[model samples]
Target: MESSVPALPSVLLKDGELKDVEAKPVIIGGMVLDIHATPSVPANPRTTTPGKVHYILGGVARNVAECMSKLGAKPYMISVVGLDMAGNLLLEHWKSAGLSLDVAAESGIPVWFEPVSVVKSKRVVSVVKHITFASPNEDELIAMANALSCGEVFSPIQKDNKKNKCSTESLFQMLRPAIWVLLEEGIKVVVVTLGSDGVLLCSNGAPGFMKGSSKGSNPHGSGNQLYRLVNSSCPPNRFFSASKFEGGSNLFAAHFPALPASVVRLTGAGDCLVGGALACICAGLNVMQSLAVGIAAAKAAVEVDTNVPTEYSLAKITDDAKSIYFATKMMFCQSML
Candidate 1:
């Protein structure tokens, strides 16, 4: 479909007109909400910042869409938002980016609000999104968790449990349909951000985990972290090299399993990481390479305090990871032989 507004220079716009054209805009369908918080930088070693909570649009769809837009990709978002002030801002952000948001559904519910928390030393931040929102029934939640976990263990935190009406299983079920819908669309790449466990990436009919160890800290530069990792790991260049998707690498990587265990910083890092990875893949790299890039992106993100000027090298990260993986493989092979 054609975008209503002009995409960045990298987008493949169909025809000369924006909107309602035959352009193959990348579609990210998900939820949007608002965030309020008091956060501090990990490097500065400061105490928490404080504030009254307010609503703002946030969610994976918006995060990825925004990142892709910045990276010169034509992205359209599909999400659930209410017609409240927060929702209005959500629409505004998309329109300003010249993104296509007409496909988004209005929930009419009170806008989802989150309070963000940040710690400087840990480079961590936590955001409570969907804090008083309605939840789906128990059966649905169970189904979702099952599908999402791929039968592995997925323990939701206690804080999340208090907000929901049913077992953790039920919550996953409720979330699955929305995720499934995005898959139904012709998305070449699908990324599922698994909070602290890392990411579940689906592309070309295969799926697997990036499986970085959890960083036990709050959410922070995760999204940017993921972006850098995926971008750097991309092929030919392999470890760390600059391409179109370098600016937000750290935020992208923040979503990897590495975040919960490594360190924490801000609320939106997961979104940023997801967006960055999407941008890298959209730029045409293979899956493993994309993942390597994502890891590097995240590593870079975790090292800094706030978003700032940064550098990335995907080839270097990939080469290092491969060398490690191969050495381990060789030892195992030698033992077997």
Candidate 2:
């Protein structure tokens, strides 16, 4: 049967002129709203301090799309905003940013806040959810887990039961099942941001094809079916590595620590990571390489107060990430030996 999906646009004009164009769209679905916040100040329980207030576009899905756009990908936003002045302004901003807003519409506003302290710590508190936002409910999550676990949803949940606060294994245990389920559902790739632990990723297969495979080799051959896991370091020096597991692999995992940065704010770091990773993948980079780019994007985001970068070069970031990845890998291996 014929499909309605249109062919991806070519990188040439109809007149046979060479051009650069991206046809693949990264559709981000979630909340959209206007954010108003005061500059960073000392934390006080019962005092009001004078500070400058600023407003900008904010939301999980929206920030992700913005990051993707900055990373040089075509992003389509599927979200709802207030029907008032804020919504109208948001639509204008999206249009100006070159995003496809055909799926965007107007609705009610969802308010959020950003609070920073003298120590430079930040916290975001969500005040409400708009009717039009698309967030997965508990039922859906449970169903996904069940399907992934092959009907083991009701099994006894494992608790970290550890007093140590810096336990990545404990945290990984808590997140592994859900991520595994998503990958099992043919998600291709799943990334989990673990605050202090850095980022963890799961995938069904390596991007592109197995390394060292002969010409005309099947990309999906059994040699590439190993499960993988990686853990990246956190903060001081963001380092990462991966391990491959043998068997009929259903999932692979890896982690990379946060890159060094003078963090101004952490507003939309996670969104930036997701958007960056997706953009790299769409650009034909492997999952591991895409993750490196994601880390670089997030590092750039925290270097400024805004959710997305005002100026960035995707090529430069990709190159920097590759260099850092190789250096970190060398250091990691040396330490292990």
Among the numbered candidates, top TM-score falls to: 2
Per-residue lDDT of candidate 1, residues 1-337 (tens digit): 1111112121211121112222223443444665655544333435554445556455645654664455444555555567887677777767432223322112111111111111110110121121111111223223333443345233332235434545323433434443332233322233444444344332222222221112222122223443344333322333122122222111111112332224444444544454444444444433344443443344444554433113434444444434322221000000001
Off by over 4 Å in 2: 1-22, 39-49, 96-174, 204-246, 327-337
Considering every candidate listed, which one attains the maximal lDDT? 2
**Poorly placed runs, candidate 1 (over 4 Å):** 1-23, 37-56, 96-234, 237-266, 296-337
Tens-digit lDDT track for model 2 on 60-82? 66777677667666655556667
lDDT (C-alpha) at residue 107 in model 1: 19
TM-score list, all predictions: 0.39, 0.58
What clash count does candidate 2 reach?
A: 11
- Against the correct fold, how does model 2 do in TM-score? 0.58
